[model samples]
Target: MIIFIDSYTEEKLANSLAGRPGYFKLFYDTENCGCNGVLAIEILDQPLDTDIRISVKNFTFLVDKQQESLFDDALKLEADRSYPSFKVSSDSALYSTNVRIKDARDMASK
Candidate 1:
């Protein structure tokens, strides 16, 4: 699959991961929503063996092996500077919008 990310989104993402030793994953979270799934940006200490890595201009994102088939061949990640959020979309429909990054490392420490 191909993913497009805007410059603002790219800068914001880079800032989030700066000085943090870990992996950035575009996770399709299926937990607790019945059959519907939601996408999340998760910061992980390391990627799972089942994760598939996709590299963009200067960033690498990980997706679960099972969820790889769910993505469209072309996807776009854009930033809404007004709301200061991230959105993921394809040609026909939106996959994820107003996405917030979840730092798993910080959460686990709590």
Candidate 2:
């Protein structure tokens, strides 16, 4: 898949991940949303065995192999600072406009 993240999204990521070393994984979070899942970005120290890596620009993202089919062949991820949210869309559909970016290390420590 192809992902194009805008400058605004880059700025937000830089601010949040400055000095942090990790891989960004676009995860299909199915924890509490029932069958219809949501997309999320989790910062990880390493890629998982089942991850499908997608490289775009200077960023590398991973998607769970099991959930790869959930996304389209092409996608664009942009940050909307006004709403303080992430937007993901494809040529034909808008997957989400409220994706979350979380620090995996922080969550694991808790």
lDDT of 1 by residue, 28-95 (tens): 77799686677888888888899987887787788888888888878899877887568989998798
Give each model's clash number: 0, 0
* Candidate with maximal TM-score: 2
Q: Work out the TM-score per prediction.
A: 0.85, 0.87
lDDT of 2 by residue, 17-42 (tens): 76776678887788978877677888
Off by over 4 Å in 2: 106-110
Worst 10-residue lDDT window for candidate 1 reads 19-28
